[model samples]
Target: MPSGHANAGYRRLFDRSGLTFGAGFPLTGTNRSTPDPEAEIELAKHAESVGFDGLWARDVPTYWPKFGDAGQTFDTWPWLSHVAAHTDEIALGTSSVVLPLRHPLHVAKSAATVDRLSDGRLVLGVASGDRDPEYPAFDVDPDSRGELFRESVEALRTVWREDYPELEDRWGRLEGDLDVVPNPTEETIPLLPTGNSRQSDEWIAEHGDGWLFYHLPESTLESYIRQWREATADKPFAIAIRVELADDPAAGPEPLHLGFRAGVEWYRDYFRRLEGYGLDHAIVGLQNDDRERAFETFAAEIIERV
Candidate 1:
């Protein structure tokens, strides 16, 4: 199914079948404090060169010690812009920007700027924020995040798509007088609401260009896809999974974090099953001690072969 957006990056990633692959950023391995910038860029280039369709960046506003994940340890805007400068064709995406923590105008403006600069390569994944401490630090009420998230989505769409949209929401009021300049490359930026954002499935289906979800069991994933199809037609569905590719081609599945440890053959079959179940894309986090070798093995085995 084709994505609603006509942008090349969007089309290349979402408007395909048979499980298009994407690499998650920082492209560095887990439990790392800071990513090596030069190596990360090289890896990003490698990912694009190897026929990966997209690269995903996460939004972690303030790193919480308790949260235990630094999330690329770079601000999303500048990070994406830097990545855009380095790569040519791969789509750039936010794993999710925490909407309630940021004003919609800023989110809209920054996103539009990246979209234009990247030549329409941005796909925004928005969330209602999960970290409890971040809410107080940002001066947002955790209980009200769901409402703020909905309002922010509305505001972002209005500012991007309408020339002088009149909006009177909690974010602020625009009287149809001033406009947010440097509008997106497309009429509307593709928005994929991540994990419901505290809204109903019907709401996400109606509002989002697609759905971005975490890894789920096969049966559960199929059920979710079936429900999504019932809610809307043609919108894409994407999932992110953490994978550790085993050396032996015939190695079977073993449990890992949010994904599994398996051989190329097992993954090939697993992804084919996902494709059969109507999945549009899979964003993979390669977990290995050797990053470059892991990427090469994945490309040679799963990506190129699958």
Candidate 2:
């Protein structure tokens, strides 16, 4: 894919070489409970001020206690729009929207609205619905989610790029007589399919503008990046990691949820290693009681150094 074809958010958050770092939303301490709205906004501004490339928001329509995370506890569209209004320059991303749970047209409209509102700072990350309980609650078939995921991606592209495009699929049909309004800031918003969305690697590589992956060990991540490079030459590859910065600057790495508890020096090395493997971006969630200090430390110690 040509670099110029992507939206500002995509370009700002990714590059052909090296890695850009982004901060995940709900920047307050990790309690999984509802975070203060005011504090979140403040931390968001702080993140951009410190030079983080992007800010990510997750989509969790309903709270599933068993799942153990509320994911910002708000709808992705409004929450992102709110964040966009409060900050400038920092890219705004949907860590992922659950595509199969919502209609494609609705997703298209909401995504484009945010993109336009943010002046092309929306990088949409979409995923097949993962929570089993969400399937029946939304009256959607879990068995057909893979197909729905594919169709949703196709529908979004059609509605965004074409005027009243004729699109017929398992979801519904667009007759070419009606059009979705509020096109994205660019020709189309960057669509990054998350964790394969139950689709084949070939399907994802062919359809997605980029790919969003979960945290993996260094060796495993290298293998995945090698495979991704083989599949697509220029599309970006991003991973999300839960990071806890140890106060001691030289503390060795200790395993945590999907990431690590390490000193600042270790993080710098880790990010450099990721860049060496051709990883484009890292969405980091800081686990700390003092969110402000964490942002500053990460900016000075890891993001800047890397």
Off by over 4 Å in 1: 30-32
Model 2, 177-296: lDDT tens per residue?
Answer: 999999998888998999979999999999998899999989999999999999997888999999999989999999998999999999898889888888989999998778899999
In each prediction, how many residue pairs overlap at the backbone (N, C-alpha, C within less than 3 A)?
Answer: 0, 0
Which digits, one per residue and each the tens of the lDDT, describe model 1 over residues 188-302? 7898999879999989999999999999999999999988988887999999999998989889999887999999899989988888888898999998878788888888887
| Whole-model lDDT values for every prediction | 0.89, 0.89
TM-scores, all candidates, are: 0.97, 0.97
Q: What lDDT, from 0 to 1, does candidate 1 have? A: 0.89
- lDDT for model 2: 0.89
